[model samples]
Each structure stands twice: as C-alpha cells, then as structure tokens.
Target: MKISELFYSIQGEGKRAGMPSFFIRTNYCNLRCMFKSGNLCDTSYTSWHPDDDKNLGETSIESISDKYREFLCKDIVITGGEPTMYADELLLLCKKLKKVNKDSFITIETNGTFIGEFINYTDLISLSPKLKSSVPFDTPQKKMHDKSRINLKVLRKYNSLYKAGKLNIQWKFVFTSGEDIKEIKSLQSEIRFKNENVFLMPEGVSEKDLKKTRPETVKACLENNYNYTDRLHILIWGNKRGV
Candidate 1:
C-alpha cells in the first residue's frame, strides 16, 4: 500500500486518547479540511499538500505488521490522510494483525468519507465526519469534500457493526464554536447517536491554538452531555510528525 510514517505514539484523540499505540499513517487524503483555527490539516505531510515525503512509499503488509509488533503495544492505529482509500491493503493488514495478535486493539481514524469491509476487524471506528467548519467556499475541493463527508446510510452500517460487538465507535466532531454544537445536534437527530458515543474535540494543531478554542468546545460538551478529548499529542509535542 502507499504509505506515510509508521511510528509508536500515544493515541491523541477520540475514545482511545492517551493510550499507547502503533500508528500506520497512510499517504494521501480525499478531503482537505481547512480547520477553523486557520491551520491546514496537521497530517498534510501525508497529503496532497504534502510538506515532507520522506515517509512516502509502497510497502507490504508484512513490513507494516512486523513494525507494529516491534513496538509491543496492544493498540494499533490505522490512520491516514485517508486509510479507507487503501481498502484492500488495509484489509490485508488487519487480517495479518489479527492473525498475529488476537487481542490487539485497533483504531481507524477517518474522515468518514469512504469505508470498506475490512473495518469489521477494527476495535474502534474513530469516525471524524468533517463539520461545516472544515468546508471552504468557492473551491472544487470543497465540492468534492462536501459531497464525500457524510452518509447516513454508511453510518447506519457502522452502527450495526457496533451493536453486533464487531467494534466500538465514536462520532468525533472537531468543535470550533457554539455554532458547531447546533450542527452536531442536527446530525445526532438524524443518526440518533447515543450521547455517550458523541465526542467533541477542540480544533487546533498547536497548544496555543487549542487553548484559544477550548472554552467554547468545553461548553458545548458540558451542556450537551457529550464526551470531550484533548489533543494530547499536540499538547505534548507541538505539531511535529512522527510522534
């Protein structure tokens, strides 16, 4: 599969926040989220607007699994610029991981734009469906990103996976302000997400930026009974890659 950096880092967001994990960050993305904090998406190194391509390559599942095992961690994160774009490769990687370590905890960080059957092997679907705050106006990429960002039909399929104990899931939205609270409410009304599964994360790539956005995001989570997570990696390591 086409790949980016692979490293051992603490899980920084969603339900698995702050846990020891191995990350296989795939190269490339389907959407370019212009975060409300005025920062480009933090994973841009693996993106179309790539900053450093040192980690870019095509490697086998054997190599990936061996590196993940080398870390000796129970948790593994299959992340991306958009990992679902590599559905077949991801499927094979998951199969290899499961065969090697049946008790492995796996998380797939995604924009919720594309999903494939291999996801059934995941332990948590860390689905961050892009909020309107991510949308940029008057751009072709915007239209493509907007169209690909949400699908209730696809979400329902994931809900079924959750219900059948195939995996856990979280509706993790990057919260920019109170307006996003209203949008999250509207989305929940459609999907009927359990309040417990809803997570609100402050938008930013640096500690300073996260500080500025936390208050509004915190208020939204408190008032709505949703879970809140800090971006532990950003707080600890700034925006540096290969954490």
Candidate 2:
C-alpha cells in the first residue's frame, strides 16, 4: 500500500468518536479540499502535497496488521488521502486485520468516489461525500475536484449495501454553512438513505473555529434530524497530525 502514517489513537470523528483505535492513513487523494473558511484540507500532506512527508512511502499489509495487533485495539480506521484509491491493497489489509482477530472492528474512511470489493471486509464505511464548498478556487485541481467529488451511483450502492445488511454505513458531510443543508437534502432525497445515518460536522480544524461553527451546526442537525459529530482529535490536539 502507499502508506503515509500509522498510529494508535482515539477515533476522532463520525459514529465511533472517542473510541481507542489504530489508524492507517494512506497517502494521496483524488480531491484537493479547500474549505469555505479558507482552510486547506486538514491532512493536506496526504492530499494537496503528498511529498511533504519524505517518509511517506510504501509499507506491507503485514506490518500494518502487526502494529494493530501490538495496540490490541478493538477498532482500526483506514483513512486517506483516500484509502479507496488502493482498493485491492485495502482489501488485503482488511482481510489481514480480520485474520488477526475476526472480532476486531474495521472502518474505512473515504471521499465516496470509489467503490470496491474492500467494502466486504470493512465493518463500517465512513463515507464523506464532498460538498461544493470543498472545491479549491482558481487551482488547477478545481475542475477535477469539482467533477469527481460526488458520485451518486456509488452513494446509492453503499446505501443499498446498508439496506441489505451487507455492511453498516454513515453518511457524513462537512458543513460550511446552513446553505450546505440544501445540497445534503437534495442528495438524501435522491439517495433515499435513512436520515438517522446522516451525520453533520462543522468544517474547521481549530477548536476556536469549530466552536464558532458549533451553534449553527447543532441547529442544522436538530432541524434536519441528523446526528452531530465533533472532531474530537482537533479539540484534544489542535490541528496537529498523528493524534
């Protein structure tokens, strides 16, 4: 796999927030996310400029599993850049993790642009479909990012899998403003996913910024009957990497 950083830390976002877990952050992303607040993607080293980390190189799936075994953690989160970009390797990694311990929970966080066999091995799919607000203005990637950010067909497949009990899924959206709710509603209407599975998170990497957006976020969640998730990692460690 094209690996970036591996660490044992608490699950920082979505349904498993605060749970002790191991992280396998894959390098390279399909999208370059620049939020409406003018903050570049929080983990830009893995996306916007992957080479920023000279040590960002390949590692075997065996080594990844060994590290998880060392932690003996109940959960392992495979995040990105875009973990789904390495679909076959991700499948192998998930298989190895299950082989090590069948009961260990596995979560794969992705931008929802790719769907693959790896979904079968994962316990939960943390699917964050990027909103238009994530498009970086005036960048060469803006067109590509805007065009590739959302895939309704892929989203529908995930929803169908969840409906058939093949795997669990959470539809998480990073909101920049209440106007973002319109896009979310439109997607939910087309996807026909259950509202309960929807999670709304404010777009911020700082505690203060998150605090600034919390009220509107909470209100939006309440109004739409969606769940609210805070970036616990950000609150606990500012915007630093490796939790």
Candidate 3:
C-alpha cells in the first residue's frame, strides 16, 4: 500500500471516539480543499501536496500490519488524503490487519467521493462529504473541487449499504457557521441517514480555534439532533502530526 504514515493514537472522532486506535493516513487526494478560514485541510500532508519531511512511500501490508501488533490497539482507522484513491491496496492491507487482530474494529475515513467494494469488509465507514465550506480560494482548483467533491451516487450507495445492514456508517460534516446547519438539513433530507450517525464537527485545525467554535457547534448539534464531536488530538497535542 502507498502509505503516508501509520501510527497509534486515541481516535479523535466518530463512533469510535476516545478509543485507542491505529491510524493509517494514506497519501494523495482527489480534491484540493482548504477551509474557508484559510486553514488548509488538516491532512494536507497526506494530500496531493506530499510533505517532503514525511517522504511517504510504499510498504507491504505485512510490514504495516506488524506495527499494529506492536501498538496492540483494538481499533484501526484507515484515513486519507483519501483511502478510496487506493482501494485495491487498501483491500489487501485491511485483510492483513484483520489477520493481526480479527476482532479489531477497522474504521475507514473517506471523503465520500469514491465508492468501493472494499468498504464492505470495514467495521465503520466515516463519510465526510466536502461541503461548500471546503472549497478552496484558488479559482481553478476551487472550480475543480466544487465540481467533483460531492458525489450523490456514492452517498446513496453508502446509505443503501447502511439500510441493508451491510455497513456500519457515520456521515460526518464539518461546519464553520450556524448557517451551515441549513446545508446539513438539506443533505439529511436527501440521504435519510440515521440522525445519530450524522456527526457535526467545528472547522478548526488548532486547540484554540476548536475551543472558540465549540459553543456555537454545541447549540447547532443540540437543535439538529446531530452528534457533536471535537478533534481530541488537537486538544491534547495541538495540530502536530504523527500522534
């Protein structure tokens, strides 16, 4: 698999929040999104703009899975840049991780732009569809990202999987303003995902920004019946990587 970084950390969001988990952040992204606040997507290092410092490269599934054995965590989170970008490799990698710990809860964090059969074997699928708030300021990139980011077909596929008892799913959305609630409501009407499975997270890359935005996010979640989750890693270790 083409991995950016693999490490163990407490899961910072979703149904598995607070659980000690292994994080496999894969390299490359289909969309070039940055927060409206000008903070680049938190995983930019794992995105199309690869960080020279990390120097992400390919490694065998057995090698990466061995790290999980070392960490001894029960949950494995395969996140991105966008994991579905490497669906074939991920399928092979997940199978190896399962060999290491069959009981492990394997979670995949996705942008919901790509639908893959690989998701069938996962324990949890956290779908974060890019919102208008994620559109970048650069004109051409913004146009491209806006054009390709939200794929209703993929979302419906995930919704169908959940309703059919084939998938355990969470629809995660990032928000910066109370106005964003209207956007979520509109999407909820379309997908009809379980309300509790819809998680609303504030758009922030640092502890201070996250704390500042928490109050309004709490109100929005309360009124909308959406689960509110903060990025615990930021609170515990700022926005530094390799946690």
Candidate 4:
C-alpha cells in the first residue's frame, strides 16, 4: 500500500472515538479540503501537501500487517488522503490484517467518493462526505473538489448495506455552521441513513477553535438528534502527528 504514516493512537472522532487504535494513513487525496474560514484539512500533509516530507512509499501488505501485530492494538483505522483511491491495495491490506487477527476491528475512513473491495471487510465505515464548506477558494483544485466531493450513489449503497446488516457505517460531517446542518438534513433525507448513525464533529484542528465551535455544533446535533463527537486527539494532544 502507498502509505503516509502508520502509528498507534486513539480514534479522534466518530462512533469509535477514544479507542486506542493502530492507524494506517494513506497517501494522496482526490480532494483538497479548505474551509471558508481558511482552515485546511487537519492532515493536509496527506492531502493538499502530500509530498511534504511524509510519504512512506509503497510498503508490502505483509509488512503492514506485521507492524499491526507489533502494536498489539485491537482497532485498526485505515484513514487517508483517501484510502479508496488505492482500492485494490487497501483491500489486500485489510485482508492481511484480518488474517493476522480476525477479532481485531478494522475501520476505514474515507471521503465517500469511491467504493472498494475493502468495504466488505471493514467493521466501520467513517464516511465524511464533503459539504460546500469544504470547497477551497481560488485554487485549481476547487473545481475538481467541488465536482467530486459528494457521491450520492455511494452514500445510498452504504445506507442500504447498513440497513441490511451487511455493513457498519456512520455518516460523519464536519460541522461548521447552520449551513452545514441544513446540508446534513437534506443529505440524510436523500440517503435515508439511520439518524442515530450520524455524527457531527466541529471543524477545527486546535483546542481553542474546537472549543469555540463545540457549542453550536452540539446545539445542532441536539436539535437534529444526531450524535456529537469531539476531536479527542486534538483536545488531548494538541495538533501534531503520531498521536
């Protein structure tokens, strides 16, 4: 797999938040997420500036699984710039992880733009479909990002699998403002995902900014009956890599 970094850390958001987990952060993203407030994606090194001193060029699946075994962790999170971009490699990696320890839970975080073989094996699908708030300003990637961010077909399929018990999925949105809530409502109506499976996390990488946004985010979650998740890693460790 083409990897950026692999380490052990607690899941920072979503349903599995606070769980100590092994992380496999993939390299390259199909989108460049820049919020209107000028905040870039938390892991922009894996996305917008992917090659800036962090690329761990293509490692073998065996090597990855071996590292996980060394970590002695129960949960493995395959996050990304966008994991599905390397679809076949990701599927192979997940298969190796399962083979090593079938009981170990695997979570794949994605932008919800693509579906892959890894879908069948992942225990949790952390789907963060980019909202209008994620669109970057005055950049060449803006057009591509806006055009490819939301894929209803993929979202509907995830919803179907979740309802049928074939998949465990959660819709995680980066809550920025009331506009985000409006978009989430419209999306939920279209995708018909379980309201209880929806999670709204305030969009920020720093404790101060996250603290500033939490109340409004919590308020929105309360009104919509959606679950509110905090960026536990940021709050606990500040904004830095490798936990």
Error of model 2, residue 75, in angstroms: 0.3
C-alpha lDDT of residue 217 in model 1:
85
Q: How well does candidate 1 score on lDDT at residue 159?
A: 74
lDDT per model vs. reference: 0.84, 0.90, 0.85, 0.90
Model 1: residues >4 Å from true position, as ranges? Answer: none
Count of steric clashes across candidates, in order: 0, 0, 0, 0
The candidate maximizing lDDT is 2
Worst 10 residues of 2 by lDDT: 47-56
- Clashing pairs for predicted structure model 3, backbone only: none
After the best TM-score superposition of candidate 3, give how far the Cα of residue 1 lies from its true spot, in angstroms: 1.8
> Cα miss at 88, model 1 (Å)?
1.6
Query: What tens-digit string does per-residue lDDT give for candidate 4 at 49-155?
Result: 87746578688888888889898688999998899999888888888898899988999999899898788889999999999999999999999999999999988
lDDT of 1 by residue, 21-69 (tens): 9999998888877865567788877764764448758888998888877
TM-score of 3: 0.96
Candidate 1's displacement at residue 175, Å, is: 0.4
Which pairs, if any, clash in model 2?
none
